[model samples]
Target: MKPTAPRYDAVIMGGGLAGLTLALQLRQRFDDLSVLVLERRAHPVPHAAHKVGESSVEIGAHYFDTVLGLKPHFENEQLRKFGFRFFFSEGRRDIDGVTEIGASRYLSVPSYQIDRGILENYLAQEAARHGVHFADDAFVRRIELAEDGATHHRLQWTQGGETRDTEARWLIDACGRAGLLKRKLGLAQPNDHDANAVWFRIGECITIDHWSDDEAWRARCDPQARWLSTNHLVGAGYWVWLIPLASGSHSVGIVADQKLHPLATIDTFDKAMAWFATYQPRLYEALDGKRHLLQDFAFLRHFSYGCKQVFSDRRWALTGEAGLFLDPFYSPGSDFIAIGNTYITDLIAHDRRGRSIEARAQLYDQIYHSFYESTLALYQDQYPLFGDPEVLPVKVIWDYAYYWGVLSQIFFQGRLTDLALLGSVRDELQHCQRLNLAVQALLRAWSGASEKRNRAAMLDQAAMPWFAELNRSLNDRLDDAAFKARIRASTAQLRQLAGEILARARDCDPALEAVALEALLAHPEYRGAQRLSAAPQHDGAMLFAVPAG
Candidate 1:
């Protein structure tokens, strides 16, 4: 009699950030469930230059620090992020002379700059310590997914010149762009946002504080730790990111609209330098001396994509880049991974309990796609406003408010899969989504109508006490009633903020007609809260960008 394949509870393909985190989460939750992670790359991958996703925002930070219990590692091994900073220095070398947007001090909630190699290595050890069977250097060769719940899924992989086969009740693809299951199942879908990116790492840090000698400019940020922030040097249709790593190396990348800046212009290291020379000369000058320190150079054209389905009732799923990828402008790669892995883990839990997961899987997929679509709206066709100091600052504020007010609230409060609460606030959620869409359109129009102000001033994000409070509120553990009330309050806040944005845009450019936003504001159910006293007054001296003198 032929021996049957050994079966495990879960088989995770690819032991990168997504897979490793999922494995850790599963073991943490189930304790005794058998989980296997197959990773093509060997352990102890080289530090400082292994991957591009080094920055972490609120959701990703919470997932890593709180969910995975890696705060000690984060505090010790990673750089605590100083929040996002931006400089509208397109062609000039005097970066301080450009309009700056960031916080004056660290906000209430904390985030970090992750070193991918370091984090992955530590995650592997943690997952193993948690009793996950992690197999590094195992390349998945083939996957035969079970069509029904009755049969187990088959996974074939090779490691150390030996082939191995395993059967698993759950097969999860966290392959990160190899998209093994995504290709086999024909899940790849194209999105409208056609953007490109090229990133490489240098052996040493690129300190932005030392770039300018302006004493007043240098004194703006408390602690003068500008190097720790994810600094964005912006231009029309393009932005360059500077992210510092704990490994003493810095990650740098240029993300741009394909039509405005073709990939061919900066696909290679030499071409990137030349492109920067003409567009961001300061960065060009900084890197011109250290080209030899380039650790890795990789570029992706049309990087943003959609997946037809990620979670399925078939007991299979995709996470990380294996599913879909949006732009890295806000460092959302890790956040999506967190969200996806959570949904996948929840579905598995349901299945293990003998509860039907078909409907739950579909529901989670819909909700997940809703998130993807909303985030896509933030980036689609909005690159033209990257350099618009007059509009981009407001856009950034609105974007953060939306992120923190709605999505972050749900995730941070552990209400991601709370159906009853979500259903109760369904209308408000839909209204917020509509509000975001309208605001994005308004921003594009506002940018077109404005004079494109660029001045040497700081737009401090934490200046608004309420905004700082919102960031701080993420740490609060809310009961169901309080959570619902919070969601309602957040909806109202987003409505008021949207109204303020629209009003401000009209103040700057009266001809700007945002019909959809106006209609939404007109609705009685979603009216702007009595002119936000917390909001800065519309004076020349405010926390927003103003016309250059």
Candidate 2:
């Protein structure tokens, strides 16, 4: 950036995924506006063993592929993920004999196993190519946010033993967990989801499909490409993720409840190996054979957290890890990046047009926080149910249904910035959020009451036409009217499904107590609860397929 070129329109701190993506979005949205991104790390970051969060679900995938127009890079560089796969085998060595909960075939909506280093490098390069200055190896020594009514916030960074200063009207903190602004303002808040993570990268891919020799197990999958999936080896209060990267390395992680599997147990690499031996021995033996291929290992204690605020009226904002991060179980890191970046882009554009932005910023902050809280419900106080194959399968279906049905549709349809539309569907959206909280509570109660159904069978999601169609519908193209209608319909679908799930839980355990769901079902307006709910989706596939009398 030219020192004498006057102030930048926006200065983004910490050129990680969020910072670089914000820079790109700002540059793309306002071509003539000047944007500068500062990063402490040097570029061309080491590939393969770079960073965690390699998996991407629908929301994040749509952001990178469609919104950012990086579809070519996805096709050429990244590995197309085979959807989120989960195995309920806890202690047993044989994965084939366990209950698997994922699609037998690939879902129509595509996501990717992102190589973080590669993706960030591309973002930085793309930003620079588009005239947005991305400065690496620049340490932000001090951040002096603007005072009340101040036009610009001042920032100082050091590079090559020289300190430099600049000012910008808009400042965005995307410094990952560093939380430069979040700490400076004491915006950090305690999260209820106290989970820890220990992750490492292997030099080469670890194939799960080869773990068993049973011909029947081998023949279960059509293509027998389980290795391509973001395979989760799940247990009681923990789950191990095995993600294959296009960089020829596989990313492996163990995320567990702090109460169930403490951080001390898997803090170090050797401890991680030891934990694997106890919890996942088959994987342990595989890694032990090629221990020399271990590339990098790291751990995070209570990995999830929140910020008191992300966007501010003082012309500042925090994105990605600088903001609130719920959990990585569903790989939601990049998806938030997409949403935050989009909101920031709109805010900047609105300001440039001399529009009043304080109210909008406050509203956006509230909406984003709501999204965080709702997503957090999925993991908070719900880890104990992770190992319960019966409850977990239902939870997975409900979680994905909510994701694809509501959030994904809103994002995929680009209705995020449409404040009017969000307002219009306020009741429906609130109902969806309320329904999610209720469903999560009901699932926990059902898990506590129900007997452990240890059936050694795989419940293939793809085999379920309704589940497969829910995954496929994420790729649908809809006009403005159709998009709004689709979201409303999806909300209704979730409500109906939630009712059905509650009824089935009650049926299984007649004495089960689901206060929220029970109250809703008892309401005179709810007629379906008296009967079995079999809500058909757009594909006319029955979502709430209860047993026939």
Candidate 3:
């Protein structure tokens, strides 16, 4: 369908995080551009509290503060600082060190244990301050593009028993997991096998006395601690998160796969608590025997969905989960929303300044997709071992380093234009994949050997070489200022190499592309037999997880 230029610059559907954030970005970037936000709910204020992605790693927090100009309020209301911490359920061991993965005193930044409803209300107010109009309780019936296709979106919505037609030059989909426009356009496709989640908030608090003597830990655990967040991997396909809010309350929830809890049902607070008791006794105990449940448990399946195209010839773009979602293990959900908002605003500004929207949109899509693919690879490699006690140190260190490193460069340094950052991320992801494959290979080789002998042999022969190299690389790079400088230089060079590789792929140089993909998949630090799988098609792309037998 064709689209005609409309009176308003953009119309944002679903006034949640993505919608309101994008609206604010658009208004901030272009003073004269008119933007309208439509929300289905009458008021976005918290009634029954809910927990979405509560832990915002450093980069996510940085984006919120620096890009959105929301740092001040976030610091005041929702921000907290803690060096990253995680627990392995099998042995409940603690691993601590100082590296990218073990940095001490990393800012917890401004992650929220916020009610989505309350957050949306604040976002609406912020958007209003930027001159974006907001309409609540307006459910959109359908969207029709104009005939000319010159940037137009027509929305049919029902509000107060009246059907109204709203038109805009651009339409943004921030409808989250609902994927309203994505499904309507037939652009939505599942990225991975269905993953389900059951999440709700509990009023109980979990105290960590282990760090009682550490000043940082003491502050974080204090009753007055406004932004306390903690997490633990319970077992395969299950994890728990605890987040403290400013209201002198905490939010607790568990996310697990249906396969892990086939009989678990969260119909009531008591049922949810009982399920937690069965699966995560420590967390259940930390909640002080009996805790108040804030809302009914919610399930999310088909969790990772993305559109084939994020933008159209007509005036429409996807943001947040409407565009793409991966596993929430790293709290990328809200980060993507903020990132998309920034990108969309930049595209709009370029268009207003006489640049080509199509070209900008294409570039935007490529960059976003590449980032998503790289991140997904990282998560996929880590998910299987999330609950393994033996690997707790590895997981904690890797996660902390990766999360804080990105946050430091992006937010603290304000270096978003550096493609090197993404390249480094790709490198880390590939390394992780290699480690996982090597571990699997060693396990299979030792199937008939005694557990102690096999474990000792594998540790000494198969894992140590790569583990040493990784440890050395991490320590060398993170231990000194010179190492950080070297990393930045190396990353720049790598990004240039990646660009060339991308060009080769496009030019149909299959052999060269294959070589590059192999290089990405091969980690010299890993010394073990290779697992059988298709050669990588893209440098940072994740192969789908093999289902458990």
The prediction achieving the highest TM-score against the true structure is 1
**lDDT by residue for model 1 (391-505), tens:** 9999888899889888999999899988888999899899999999999999999999888878879888877776787788888888887777777777777777787788788
- Candidate 3 shows a clash count of 8
Q: Alpha-carbon error at 365 in model 3, in Å? A: 0.9
Ranking by TM-score: 1, 2, 3
lDDT of 2: 0.84
What are the per-residue Cα lDDT tens digits for candidate 2 across 1-549? 334525899999988888887887788788899998989899978888887878888888888888889999998999998888888777788887677877677778899999988888888889999999878999988777778777888878888888788889999998889898988999999887889999999988899989999888877777788888899888889999999988888899999999999999999989998888898988998899788889999988888888899988688999999888888889999899889999999998899999999999999999999999999999999999989877888898899888888888788878899999878878768878888898999999999987666566766777777677667777777776776677667766776678778867887798888888766545454334222122225444344343222
Whichever of 1 and 2 has more lDDT, that candidate is 1
Candidate 3 pairs with clashing backbones: 2-146, 2-149, 3-149, 3-150, 100-401, 101-397, 101-401, 466-525
Q: What's every prediction's RMSD, in angstroms?
A: 2.4, 3.0, 10.4
Q: Which stretches in model 1 have alpha-carbon errors above 4 Å?
A: 1-3, 528-548
Question: Per-residue lDDT of 1-549 in model 3, one digit per residue for the tens?
Answer: 223323578888888878887887777777899998888877756632644765665556656666678876676766364433444433222211111111223332334444455566788888888898888888889887656644566778778887777787778888776777888888876666345565665544445443224454333333423225444444555666666555445566565555554424643567767766666555556554545545445666546665687865455788887788887666777767766777777777766787677765776677677567656654543444445433433334333334333333343444343445545555543443343333333222222121211010101111223222222232221323433343343333233333333332333333232333345434354323232121111233111111222
* Candidate 1 weakest ten by summed lDDT: 533-542
| TM value for model 1 | 0.97
Q: How far in Å is the alpha carbon of 421 misplaced in model 1?
A: 1.0
